[model samples]
Target: MPADAARTDEEWTSLGRSVLLRQLALGARSRHQLDRKLAEREVPPSVASALLDRFVEVQLIDDAEFARMWVRTRIAAKSLSRSSLRRELAEKGIAVELVEDALEQVSDEDEIEQARDVVRRKLRMSADLADRTVREKEMRRLVGVLARKGYNPGSAYSIVKEVIAGAAADAAEGAEPEG
Candidate 1:
């Protein structure tokens, strides 16, 4: 007979708790993620539900907090736009409302600034921006980079234009003959 064949509900609950605690120790997880982990371990449905409920009751599991921290960290580290962050949270099974609450922490100015910074970094690594053809190609490539990072097309185009123009002006100022 299988080892679990003779286990009682209490035994299954204990196993579930052990698995949950271990997973939590690694990092915060959404309720959905924990549920999937329990399911993968083949813990009985009722026992898994009970254990998860208890964890929630004691605040060991909080999707809201997880979403908030995730948003803050991803934005700071990746310079991701709100759309990209939304897609990431949704993939993690966070509820729409919780995702919105977390996204509220990122203001419009914050998004624009992050986008500008991304464009500036890309512009710095490219070929000369003084050549008309090179500047146009760089503009398209930079805008595409921001687009992939989840900026709106119009906004991405505008930011790329603004950053490239600033870089070109800086380069021109440096090239001017000394008095």
Candidate 2:
């Protein structure tokens, strides 16, 4: 919302509607996010409440659906972990129950794969290193990466080990001469 724009609307309902639509045009927003934005814009609570109820009435605002979509997008685009996704959705003002439910969308296998994917991309650069200590150090760093992305230590260690072994196998295969 522009700083100079006056939110003091004699017709409060229309003002809320206009502001909401403008925000929505920019991107999909959660109901909580919209409420905050309206408050920041100085819209009256009564008007904001009325407008929000109407939006939800028309399916223009759905927190449950928003949580689901948000989880899916972040997982696909950023490979976030279930715990990380849950925490993020909660921060976004989605209900804790809905956040947990949305986090369920990422299966355990998907979580493992996401961890593997993170470590796999980093493993290639460390693949041919000669120092065992240096290679293990690099693997630890990769594991830390997964840990920050919300994998438990065990899962992170397992992923790091798997990717390292797979990279080694690929290197060995590539080095062998044709029979």
Candidate 3:
């Protein structure tokens, strides 16, 4: 065993706290997630607990703020649905109430538009495919992508259809001979 592994529990605890502090400085993390990570790194339960408590006391690990930021980032980057976001927050160890509050800040219209934008961006990359095939494939692909991104099936389907139709129209127009 390494010399460090033979150290007393208190020494290990201090080392764990230092490592966890560095991790938190890099990005936000949920208490549960951090605990799990610390455990995986072989940090003792007592040490991890103390470190987590210190973090919470210092406001470095606020579940409420974490939930809000998580929702905002996911919605803005991936256009995920409230259901998906809720599930994700739960997995990250956030309370149900906090997740609900965070979700309240995201509107249905905003999610729909974000979903549309994702589909549009993906469609642009497949411009070489034939029109009808492209529309069909993109519709299915978009719906799946949005669903995985945490969008509801109904909303994902609706937005995918709209985006596919618009792309189809554009493709047809572009193919026509200029007058």
Candidate 4:
């Protein structure tokens, strides 16, 4: 028989604990993520449950805290909209209530500003803003960027329009000759 098949429940539990600790050492993980890892390692269901339960009892596994931190970090790093972040958290097995609670941290105004900031950065890097055709293309691309980042269509279009208009006005002013 293989070594795994010969292992007792205690040995399996020990393996499960070590797995959890190693994973935790790397970063915070949702309970479901940990459960999947244990299952992947072929740890027995009972042993895995007991170990996971113990970890929860000791406060080592708090999905709420995990969800909050994940939301904060993702927003700061990627400026993702709540819808996109919600989808991501769901994929990680975060509970609906926790996901909603975490999403609450980002207000509508905050999301708008983030989108604006992203559009501004992209606009600055665009070299052909002086040409109408290139400006239109850049506007389309900026709207697409916001769409891919999960911003609603209406908001994305409006933000891009506002930013591009402001940039155009500034450029026109800069091009005028001194009186």
Candidate 5:
């Protein structure tokens, strides 16, 4: 039979299983994400749904697990705020309730530390510039960066100021004249 011939039911199931395995191998994905990807690959909805059910049954595919892992990875790697994480998870088709549960795992201290780290990194990047200009530019950049990363403006500003002040104090001490 030519390649274009419609696949037998068995062949369709086998193909879908292969595709689902490949997708899972890439990383954890929510059911919606998987469905979209499988559909994009031209898998019939029925076959895709069946394969997804099998994966779920075998514990190979899980939205709750995917949400937890996604939250952890994004927060650690990107220092994303809960808001940013929530938005990203939503965009990935995760349910809001699941996203909230995952976000709840991120403590306030962790978020503040992440925000501080973001400010420190930006401050370091702009270190060679003039102090006033550097502070102003860095404050603006850090605010925007944190905001984009899902932090509130007030928290972002406070963290940026704190980091910049610390950096300036350190620089001043290092520049002091020795006896």
Candidate 6:
């Protein structure tokens, strides 16, 4: 950006492309995100659209690819449920179809396993959950945590029950008269 600027559409187009490329270089961004950035900078709509279209053509901007990557990393790293994943991508301006497709990567079984793992990990971390009252209160909290992460009530309840029961059985076995 200089005090003296060129007065040609070509110059504006180049500038827009530079801004867009800098963003793309940082990481994947939804089309909506990119458009908002260009708009904020007062890039002409036509120039922004043309440059964005060109970027799409060159595969520099692929919403579908971005959605897939987002789903993979988020699920693996955050253990987010399909419902949570869908909502997150939608917030990022990903298309419904793409979000659904990305969510397909997580199977129902996998989601359940993740839910179970979350409950187990949380219970293990809360050593104060020793008595029945404490366990019940902690179980409710655990179920709520899962529910907030998009787990269905039934799934969260069942997983919480299973983890608590399993821990009780382990404690019972371990409490046998020490020799």
TM-score of each: 0.92, 0.87, 0.76, 0.93, 0.85, 0.88
lDDT of 1 by residue, 1-179 (tens): 99986899989998999999999999999988999999999999999999989999999999999999999899888888999999999988899999999999999998999999998877754478888999999999888899888999999999899988889888889889999
TM-score of 1: 0.92
By TM-score rank, best first, the candidates go 4, 1, 6, 2, 5, 3
Judge candidate 5 against the unseen true structure and give its global Cα lDDT, from 0 to 1.
0.83
Superposed model 3: Cα runs more than 4 Å off: 1-9, 124-134, 168-179
Q: lDDT values of the candidates?
A: 0.91, 0.83, 0.83, 0.92, 0.83, 0.85
- lDDT, residue 165, candidate 6: 85
Error of 5 at 16 (Å): 0.8
Model 4 ranges off by over 4 Å: 124-130
Where model 2 places Cα greater than 4 Å from the true spot, the runs are 1-10, 177-179
lDDT of 4 by residue, 4-83 (tens): 99999989988999999999999999999999999999999899999999999999999999999999999999999999
**Cα deviation of 79, candidate 2, in Å:** 0.4
Weakest lDDT window of 10 consecutive positions for candidate 1: 120-129
lDDT of 6 by residue, 65-91 (tens): 999999899878877889888989988
What residue pairs clash in candidate 4, if any at all?
none
What is every candidate's alpha-carbon RMSD to the true fold? 1.6, 3.4, 3.5, 1.5, 2.7, 2.8
Which candidate wins on TM-score?
A: 4
* Stronger candidate by lDDT (1 vs 2): 1
Pairs of colliding residues, candidate 1 = none
Top of the candidates by lDDT: 4
The C-alpha stretches of model 6 lying farther than 4 A from their native spots are 1-7, 125-130
Q: Which ten residues in a row have the lowest lDDT in candidate 3?
A: 123-132
Task: Please give the distance, in angstroms, between residue 169's alpha carbon in candidate 2 and its true position after superposition.
Answer: 2.5
